[model samples]
Target chain A: MNDYRITTYEPRHRGAVVEFQQMLWQGGAAGNSAYLDWKFGANPYLDDRYVTLAWQESELVGMLGVFGSCWEVDGHGRVMLPCLADTVVAPAHRGGPLFGRMLEWLVERLRADEVPWLLDFGDQPAGPAMLMSGWTAVGPWPVAVAEREVLGSGEGEWSAREAVRGSRSGATITPVATSLPEMPALAAETRSRGSVRVVRDEEYFRWRSRNPLARYFHLVAEEQGTVGYLIAHRTAVDTDDGPTPTTIVECEALDDDVWRDLVEAAVATLPGKVVTMWVRDLAPAREQSLASLGLSPTRPSGRLSQDIHLPKLVMRSTGVVDDAGPLATLTSPDVWDMRGVSGRGWR
Target chain B: MSGSHDVQDVARTVLDCLRNKLFLDGVTADTHLIESGLIDSVGFIRMFVVLEEEFGIEVTARDLSLERFQNVGSISRFVIEKLAEGGGSDKPAEAVRA
Candidate 1:
């Protein structure tokens, strides 16, 4: 029975999609519903129409969700594009052309819609398959980590929130409930250094803070004004050692000293926890700052082994761009400001 | 580390892993593990772990190409080459178990 049909997602398929996601998420139906809603249902750029589904008759056998995002190319102001995520296929349909077929359909749809290209932060299990499906491999990006031994369970004596609230080293760190009003201005003030990055506008920050799967914390640094800000989130990941408490230091200030202070305060909050942040193409000053803070680069073996597989960004053209277009810029690993680029459902 | 003996041993181990660890029956040395749907992405990782543990060879980034892992024969050859290059280590196998 190799008769698999491909179709775009509709409202009627919501229940099936949620149910199908349990195989991938294992977060139960309610959790899956909330994640789906946050990622696509309430997205500012794209709608549910971009979600593609595969079926064997009426059974929902596979799905590939394409969500919208905006990028700021150096010369270009803002370019909206789709990113592939939340891919799942039924066990009964394993090891077949179903994945390739769904991808082919999605690419065709993106081409029809005139999208220039699509991106995926492909994990270890998904990396090779994506490469085989024609996605260009741009990275096995490096990540930096700082870990400390906790005397006891819980936050111990120091509180992450309290640490930031207390001032140190010229700048004051203040924890905010959401993105600071000065975030856009602060982001604008920081130079991109000729890289394509996610547009960190007010709308993007507000939307990013609503991710239900992650508990986000925002900290703003002020010396004279809003010099910098940091966003970190805590999530539990199932590692080889069981559920590990992990804090992703998602984004921070561009200034080395301010960035160091922000990170120090953030790490102080979650004492003894494993803290990680992207370090690919990091500036020398920032790299030194992280090292001074006791964080070291954790390089992946690229074998997709037991150790954490290096996160690779994969892309494929939709045939909408010429040779001299933005595709060349996007393909270069050095051209991405990777902070906070970790996709939805990163756990 | 005799070449022919090593190849045979690697092939046997690869086939055993596919059938036992990955639960894929009838996987032969020449079977197209990838194209035949016997090994998907997750399966590929699991298989890599078995190879690393069984051979005590550190699988590096350079060894990650799809062509190198397409089938039992290819995987066996890759393992033999790695073993020949003194890739074996004294590190405990438990350290790399996933």
Candidate 2:
């Protein structure tokens, strides 16, 4: 530990970063270099120092990624906010001061650079540390689920050889293409409904859809453009009955018909699966829209809450912005009208 | 190193971190660190990190169960077993381990 040092991430450290995440998370996308490149390298919004690395001599012991985003904070208009994600520290160094040291280093740098704020959807096991470091949990937003039975089995199981190409409810739901000319303008138009959220411009949509680890489906209403998208991923969690599938949906600025069509199309694509996503309380209409399509409000709070003390959206201020002015309600979770937010879309 | 000495070194590393980083006090080998408020899940993560760096071991998700990390004695025993299995050591290896 005496040889330990912290520095900004470099391309040479890519392999080490992947290796550290593999050890910390017990291997998954963390071990994939292509995923790392897609996440950090290919991203159009990140700076060179988006990642901070901790090294014990030549070994990469820790990593914390500060994923940058353009956040619309009510009165402040749009401010650049960094979302803390994919934090990992070697287990041997967990009980030491290394983690704290790395956090302080990152916070101070962000402050010095005048970054407005830091936000995170915290890891449950790491909740105590986050709160202890002056982070505020914004509480788990209400989650809605469309169960398999209610969604109704539309077609047989999707075969592996078959491409994810289909349609339902007068819309085309297909695997997202590498590039969509309308994605940039459509994403900006979709998120311009005047609410607090991560700005999803054309570049964001393209980069997010390119995630090597997860697959996303786009629902395009004939004349409505890109109305919605869904990312359905499996979770290790199990209920009294058995294993259940989890899906995240985002369709904030869509018309009623488009939204319903997208939901039906998504459900038809992945039949008999439980689709789940966080819904903002301010947007009762969105919840109502999903409910009308057979989705129900489930008690994901008790089973999925990060911790009793830790809220779902844990935030920390860098004192670089004035929260009292136009952004007075910036820290208040109640003020965010999360109409188009989805589980995968937020990151 | 002797087993007791190794355990003492591990305990000292963990306690020193608790006192310095978290401002904790009066913790002992048998203290219920997690249950007694001396350490939370985050603190437990820190402790594991220090132990790994100090002894050169790779603690995995399977090693996170409460039984293996209840107290100083339990933690030391777990580390000693992991070290004995040659999971990690202070000695230099041919390949780098993150």
Q: Highest TM-score, which number?
A: 1
DockQ of every predicted complex: 0.27, 0.06
True-contact fraction for model 1? Answer: 0.36
lDDT of 2 at A265: 58
Q: Per-residue lDDT for A72 in model 2? A: 70
lDDT of 1 by residue, A92-153 (tens): 88677888888888899888988889888746355656665567767676666777764222
Error of 1 at A86 (Å): 1.8
For candidate 1, the C-alpha RMSD (Å) to the true structure equals 4.8
lDDT values, one for every candidate? 0.71, 0.59
Encode model 1's per-residue lDDT on B1-98: one tens digit a residue.
34454677778888888898888888887888777877787777677778887777777544677778888888888898888898876765432211
Please identify model 1 stretches exceeding 4 Å from their true place: A22-31, A122-124, A147-168, A235-246, A270-272, A291-296, A302-308, A344-347, B2-24, B49-68, B72-98
**Alpha carbon lDDT at A145, candidate 2:** 65
CAPRI-style docking class of model 1 based on DockQ? acceptable
lDDT of 1: 0.71
